[model samples]
Target: MIEIRGLTKSFHKHKVLDQIDLTIRKGDIVAVIGSSGAGKSTLLRSINLLEVPDAGTIRLDQLQVDFARKTKADVLELRKSTAMVFQQFNLFRQKTALENVMEGLIVVRKVPKEEARKIAARHLAGVGLSDRMHHYPKQLSGGQQQRVGIARALAMQPKILLFDEPTSALDPELVGEVLDTIRKAAEAGNTMLLVSHEMSFVRKVATRVLFLDQGVIVEDGTPEEVFSRPKSERTKQFLANYYRDQEPEFTI
Candidate 1:
């Protein structure tokens, strides 16, 4: 389980997150949805400390960290518990798909080269990239590259998987493949926190939904609950605008 309380962040004088509180049960696939600059990405990034918050307490299972007074070891422990799959498919330009996945095990986890190779190959295959394992990022399609990124994150065996607009940087045609990979991860019972603009997929894959506006999570519930009967007017407006071209219901 994960618990966060009084989570806050600011840049210059602008508060991006304001005393946010949230919880995620183990194996829950929670999707964070909102318009631009709604603290969606920042929330995911903050859990792993990519964008450090000014104040908060983040608890993952038995581990907890106070952002206001986190030690270096605390930061490292927090980072170790979560792995992020970024929007841009952050792979090593110089490495092949297998190498990209293996690097973390070999470098950070201190696994032997041969052992890391085996582990990486298994994860690559899990993401349906076995044939592309030897290919460099430049040689793979955007979707395939992102799959490799998924494999890399999965191989770490972190407590939670954080996805920050994993398909936003991909071509429209390629988005499905990455989303499929994430679906497979969910099927395999991996806990995940995702920030996505793909509302349709969010409804399909997410067990829970969070709608953030300004700096707060205005609505939180099952996908069906939030999408079908949002209590907050802002959430209803956002969804209505998103699915304006479709049916009155959230078919898309």
Candidate 2:
């Protein structure tokens, strides 16, 4: 299980997160939904020490870290236990898809070249990129490139996976492929925390949903609960605005 308490971050005196607390069970796919600048991405980044929160305690299973007093080793251990996929596919321009996926394994994990190659190839195929393995990032479509990012994260075999608007950069036609890959990972029982604006996708794939607004999680429950019977006015307004074009029920 993953537990977060008193998570707080500020930027030039502007509080982006305020004492955020939540728990994610093992193998759960929890989607964080909110407006822009709602602290969703910061929360995910904080988990891996990317944003360096001003105050918080992060506990992943038995390992724990206090953000205020985290050591270098603690940061390293936190990163080793989690992997993040960004909104933009951050593959190296100089590397092929296969190399991009294998880079972490060979460099960070220090796996033998042959072993890393095999592991990378398997994950690339898992994301339906076996045919694009030898292609450079520039040669792949946005969806294909993001799939490589997913393959790279999965190849790490981290205890938890964090996705920050994974499909936000893709075109409408390309979004489905990346979402499908995430769904496959969810089916395979990967623990995931996702920040996404795709309500339909979240309703379909997320085991739990969090509605964050203005630096706080206003609602947390099963997808059905939050989407169907949200208890917070902020959540209701957000969802209503997000799904204004849909049916009155917003039952995607």
TM-score per prediction, in order, is 0.96, 0.96
Name the runs in model 2 displaced over 4 angstroms: 247-252
Write down the TM-score for model 2: 0.96
RMSD of each: 2.3, 2.4
Instruction: Give the alpha-carbon lDDT of every model.
Output: 0.94, 0.94
Over 154-184, each residue of candidate 2 has an lDDT whose tens digit, in order, gives 9999889999999999999999999999999
Ten contiguous residues with the weakest lDDT in model 1: 243-252
Clashing pairs in 2: none
Error of 1 at 132 (Å): 1.0
Score candidate 1 by TM-score against the native.
0.96
The 10-residue segment of model 2 with minimum total lDDT is 243-252
